[model samples]
Every structure is written in structure tokens, then in C-alpha cells.
Target: MQTKINKVELRNLEFDDYKELKNSMVESYPEMVGSYWREHHIEKLLSIFPEGQLVILVDGKVVGSALSLIVNENLVDKNHNYSDITGKYTFSTHNPKGDVLYGIDIFIHPNYRGLRLGRRLYDARKELCEQLNLKAIVFAGRIPNYGQHAATLTPKVYIEKVKRKELHDSVLSFQLSNDFHVIRVMKNYLEGDTDSKEFAVLLEWNNIYYDESPKLINLEKSVIRLGLVQWQMRQLNNLEALFEQCEFFVDVVSGYGSDFALFPELFAAPLMADYNHLSEADAIRELAKHSEPIRKRFQELAISYNINIITGSMPYLEKGTLYNVGFLCKRDGTSEMYSKIHVTPNEVQHWGMTGGSKIRTFDTDCGKIGIMICYDVEFPELSRLMADEGMNILFVPFLTDTQNAYTRVKHCAQARAIENECYVAIAGCVGNLPKVNNMDIQYAQSAVFTPSDFAFPSNGIKAEATTNTEMTLIVDVDLDLLKELHEHGSVRILKDRRKDLYEIKKINT
Candidate 1:
């Protein structure tokens, strides 16, 4: 009487499926004739806890069902019996304030047996447990075939045999394969049952992903505050002086309770003063030699101030090649480096630096973030790819020497914020370095930008600094609000992106 199902759909149990559920239960568990759930019982369970009820439909016909209820663990301790936990098969012990999920029953039609339908139902229950943040799922599984050995062996001995793989019970074997471990055997779990001589196996599946800590819900409290310093370029007498200047900014920003502080690209150019006797290209090469010490100092500052620092851009030399790389020093004394992906003509022709090929995003405790140096943000495809990878914030560090160069970076940064629906923070180097070559006559303005919508500020600017000024602008960004706007905004740009018509695919080299 087996029926081959062509199409299968899984959905939450509705009132209209009560009759089908009753029929399916009866057909699936014929041994429990009087134990079959009535239609009214199904309706009552759905009305009270609909999220825990689910059904599997095969070509518009109900073929399987899984039902669960929430319960407090304190009420059902380690030694509690099944009848007391579920209230005599009526689920009167269901608790809305419970942290654990209690599995009441699951059945698939006899004709649809061996189709892996039961596995799908179990997976759905696991997913529901995660969404509700439940602690674990507990159930009493019947060992139907244990009745045959009841005359010679006790329930404990039978379960041991099954665990050792010397014996197989239909229900216990299936549950074990699905990651449910047996706690112990329960006597008189189901009255008048032929299975296990009226005994059942207590099983549980723990939710490993459950977080006991409270979630970040308050917008203000959940905000990640950033202090952006538009560093002023100047003549430096020595490396010690340059380090002292950097520490001054960090000390000031740390007092304001900022979680992260950002600096401009090539802000360390003044450190190249020690090598001014060499050519412009040789000077950058000399700066690259101090990359290790520079990174070590940034890491120490990050740990000392208890703040994450973005060390703008440094001339990094590796394997006989020079690169314009930015370093992110985390508060935990760790760091990550991102090489500039789009090198400007000045970088390639004058500094002998090449562009990086790979685009990457960093995973932090606050949120997922991406770093694109100056010219990189101008390319729309790069930011879009990063947004696709769940980046909520994009940091741009620039070192523009002219108003026109600064405008190009600023406009493209704003456009990226709109197209990707993400926060964009731009910081640049300012002031004039008269004695330093290729670093003099800087023009810059730093800003924190947001998406253009009703939920955001009217001007889309969270905070901005005065043009060509040496200042640090602090701003707080709400990650939860960003998520809400992405889903229910005035215009859903991330959702409306036409992937079918066109997509920005990264070609692996």
C-alpha cells in the first residue's frame, strides 16, 4: 500500500489540516488505536502554540506531522514521569514562559514510510527551536520491537543492547540517528501500549547555538561608536615624535568612550622625514622598513586604550614588493591587514605600488565590516560585493591632495552607502607637509554617512568635520536600526537588486 510522493511541501499546521492530521496519525500508528489524537485536540494545540506544530504535504495531501510544546525545566526535573510532564496525554503542562521545547508526537503516513519524511520533520523542529532560542528538545520515544524481548530481558538491558548495536528498535534507532541521546528508560510512560511492555525511552536533543545572554535590543546601547581623526600632515623631526602624535589622538578619543578610532590614509607620511635625503620612491621604501614596528605600536595602543584602531594606510613591503596596506588593530591585541585594491596612477607611477586583487571583509564583535581605501570606493562593484557578504559598515581612508580629488572620494562614498544600504565612514589626511615630498599640500574633509531614506537623517550625513581641519569627529551607529531599515525601508535597494538580469561576479585568478 506504499504511495510514491511526487511533490512534497512542508508548512505550519493550520486549522484546515486537522482532519488530515488525524487520519495520518491513525494510519501511521495503528497499534495505538485509542491513543490517536482527536481533531479538537489538534485545534487546541494549534490555537495555543501554533509555531510548534508543522505538517508535511505530498501533492496537496497531508502525509506527516510533528507537534511540540514549550515547558519549564523546573517543572519536569531529571526524575519526572511522562504522564506528569504532558498531563495525561492532553499537554496541559504547556508553558509560554518555558525555555525548553517538549516534543509531544510526530507521525508519518504508513504509505509514505522510508521516504525520509520523518527526517525533514525533525529538521524543521530543530530550526524552530533555534528561532525561539529554546534550550533543548525532550521526548519519550517508544521502542515498539522491545516487546518481543520483554519476556526474557528488562527494559534497561534491551536499551543497552540497542545502544551497543546488537539489537535494533524501529523508533529508538531512528531517533538515535537524528542526534537524540537516551537519558534513561521510563516505566508506565504510555499505558496500555504493546511497545516496550508499556515502557518508553527518555531522549533529548540539546540546542548548542542557544545564547543565554540577553540580546542587544536598545538602539542607543547597541550602537557602535567611532571616533574619526582627520590627521594633519606636518614636518616630523623623528619617528618618536610621530608616534607621540598618534598616541595623543588615541588618548583623546579613548576618553570619549569610543569603541573604535579611525585615521586617514598615509597619515604616517611625516615619519618618512628621517629618509628625506633619499629620493621620493626611496623614502617610501624606507618607511616600509619600519612597517613591523609601526604595526606593533598600533597593536599596543589598541590594547592600552581598550579601543579598536584603523591605522589608515602604511607602505608595506613584502617579498621584495611594496603595497599601500591598512591595518585594523582589534582591542584584543589582534590585527588584520587589507591592501589597497585600486592603486591610483600616482601610486603605481611614483611609488612603485600595485593594486590588490582580492576584496575581503572583516568579522568583528560589533558587526561585519569592509575597508576600501580612497580610490577603491569609486568602483561600484567592489562595495556591492562586500554588501552581499553581510557587511553593514564600510570604512574608507583617503589622502587626497586637491579639492577635486577629495570630492571624487566623498561622492562615491555617499553613492555606495545608498546603493548598498550600509554605513560609510570616510577619514582623510589634511594640512600641508612642506618638507615632505609627495605628501605636501593636502586637502580633505572627513564624514560619517548613512543611507538616503526616511529612517536616516535628511542630509544622510551623521557627522562631518570642517574642510582641511585637524579634528576628530565622533558618531554612533545603530546596527539593529540598520537591519530594520534594510528589511522595511522606503525603498528596498538590497532586495530590489536584479540578480537575474545582471550580477557582479568575482573571477578567480
Candidate 2:
């Protein structure tokens, strides 16, 4: 057959060509490759050759191709051949060393064969094997006629020949002519009914090495240590007592060499008895009085200790409304505030507090930090959005008295930390708050957590203070550890999260 010749160049292939490649293969090999199983094999090929490296060109058009992947799998049986039905040409077994597999199947149009195109296509696939630095190239082809009709062959006979390399002569006839040799024949134990049609022989070419270009190593990285404090509540029947206690805790936290300290939800609150003792107006007044003192004390703490302190969640009276606010206190006594973007029904119904409308991440000298209050942590999107914004630390201030509150808190904190590759710090109210409906007020266990590790013991206790008690717990964190986990850890909780497999939506308001 005569054919036109055109320039051939190698380039990256698009994934959308899957259907086209399938159509081409099925159209040419209806007998050997059927339409029913073509989808399965094509899907496998798409996954393996996402960039379409296994391709062939004839007259500047794609005509033939092969699919392969480099994986670590043990040929444990010592009698297994992947080349036959599995189409797995390469594998590595840990015990006796391993090999990178190269698998490819080449198909030619019936009208274009007289030009020795089969060897040309095989040569093209060989180039791919060399490019991948594969150990061996293995495949199975039709068995030569054995004086019996192809339909007369039994599955047992096919399996037996596949295990014995009985067709080495015919296989080597074509392969050996191209510097290939029959190394062994192994049974397709995992092939199921697919291998019932014919037997196959495995082939290998030894001592063939390909040269690779040298790569320059770029190991430069930046590391920052971060800390989050959450769940700090300052509620006292007397505004005077609340400020006094907050001032004291600030002084004590300053005494420690903490880079950052976080306080929990509603860091400042006034006593509300059955919603009668304190009206809406009185609540705002108390919050205002506590705000300046609380802000000043945290400012002093941050400046004096040369650290950053997240003052946790406080009620910020904004225009005729109230917002749960978090602050980042800097060493210079300056502070940045982020209002809570999500509020629970309890806040809207019980506290008459509305949620904030936007997400805000702080740009710190160390790295970006995200701040959200109690109810916000319950919503995965808040933390996930912060993580997507490149925040390395999530500061959560929480207030809860639920049973196993701390355990639940710790679980969520650790999960967010691992999933976002960020640090989560929780500051919680441990002591009792004013009586609520006939139940005593609640608090969550407080702690600092990294991606896979917690700074506190496994008992889920990072640190705790008595409810309605006065205390400060300062813990140090290493941001570099988070970066390390992202770079080297196999359990990449954050990177491994499959958004395509799950629906992800954020509830901002």
C-alpha cells in the first residue's frame, strides 16, 4: 500500500480525545477489542495517560497508541503474567526488587499495512518505553493457528500456554526480529473470563537503558510558627468583675513567651437573666464598657509580650446591630477585627445576635491567619474557605457546655487542621456561665492542633480553665511543621480531598 508522508512532531494530548481514540480502536478491532469492554479499557487508559503520551501518528494523523502506568505491585505468585489480559506490562515487587511496567497496544488500519507499519508503530511504542525508563515491555498477541479452528480452543488450553510460553517461536518470530525475546509465560490468574479466548507469552528486553536529563534541585522553603486561641468568655454579673478578670488573664498571658493567644466565643458578655434583668440596650452598654478595657488589655499583652493575641469573640455593637467579633492584636498594640460570618440559631433566637456577611483573613508577618467565632467552626465551609485563601492558622473562639463538648470540639479542630493543612487553636470557656433555662452554662475543652498532631495529650485536653474561672494557657506552635506535612506526608488530608467526588458549598451568611 502507498501512503502520503507528512511531518511528525511530539506534543501533549488533550483528555477530550478519549471518545475519539475509543471510536478509532473499536472501529478497527471489532473482533479482538469489543465495544462492550472498550469503555472499561478506555477509562483505564484515560486515567493512565491523562496527558496522552502513548500516541501514534500516520500522515500527521493519530493512528495508533498504547497506555501504561508506573505502579508498585508484587507479582507474588511468581507464575503471574500481566501482559495477557490485564495489559499491565510493568510492575515492582518489594522482596526481589521491582520494575517499572510499560504496557501498550498498537492497532493499524486494514488498508495501510504493506509499508511494514506494524514494526514502525512498535518502534514508536518502544520510544515511549525508553522515555519512561521502563524495565520491560510486555504484551499478548493472537496465537498462531495450531491446526485447529480459533473457535475450537478451550480456555484451559489458553491458560496453559500462557503459563508455559509454548508459543515462543511465533511470539519471538516477530518480537525477536525487533530485538525482543520471550522471557516467560505466566497464567492470567486475575483475568477472569477475559483470558478465555487465547493464551499469551510475556517478553523482556534486558540491558537496555535510556538517558535522562539532569534535574536541578530547588529545596528552598519558608516556615512560620503560628498559634490560635479560641473559646474565651468574659461573663460576670458585674461588668467591673469581668474587666478585672480579663485584665488579670491578660497580665498572666503576657508573662508567658507565647507568640499568640486565642480566647473563645463571646469573649465579653453581661449577665442576662431570663432576658428581663438585661434589656437589649443594657447589653450593648455592657459590651461597650467591656470593649475598650478588653481591647486595651489585649493590646498591652501583645505589645508587652511581643506576641500576637487573638482576643477571641466579643460582641461588637455595629450600627443598631450586634456582631460577634474577633481581633488580632499585634505587638505594637494595634488590632485588626474580623466579624463572625456565620451565626447559629441560638445566637439569632436567644442572644438576638446577627451574623456577619463576609469572610476575612488576616495578613500576618508570619503568614495569613483566619478568624471565626463559635458557631462558625461548626460549618466546615468557614474553615475550608479560610484554608483556600492560604490561611495557615484558624483562630476559633468557642463557648459550649454540651456533654463531651471538648471531645467534639477537639475532633472538629483536628479535622479542620488536617483537612486544610492549617493550625487550629481553640480557646474555650471552662467555668460556668449564668444559668440558662434551668441548665448551667457550658464550655468546650480548649487546645491547639496541627494537621495530624495535637499539641495536647490524646485525652483531648489542650488546656482547660474552670467555668466562670480565671486562667490563661499559652502554647507554642511551629508553622513549618504544617509545610513539612504538605510536602512529604503520604496521608495528605488536604491535597487528597476530592472536591470532584463531593459537592462543596459555603454558607457565608
Top model number, TM-score: 1
lDDT of each: 0.87, 0.57
Please give each candidate's TM-score: 0.62, 0.50
- Mark the regions of model 2 whose C-alpha exceeds 4 Å error after superposition: 1-241, 270-276, 280-289, 404-407, 433-440, 453-470, 499-509
Query: Cα RMSDs of all predictions?
Result: 13.2, 18.5
lDDT of candidate model 2 versus the reference: 0.57
Question: What is the Å distance of residue 421 in model 2 from its true position?
Answer: 1.8
User: Which regions of candidate 1 are displaced past 4 Å?
Assistant: 1-221
Model 1 per-residue lDDT at 461: 89
| Superposition error at 231 for model 2 (Å) | 8.3
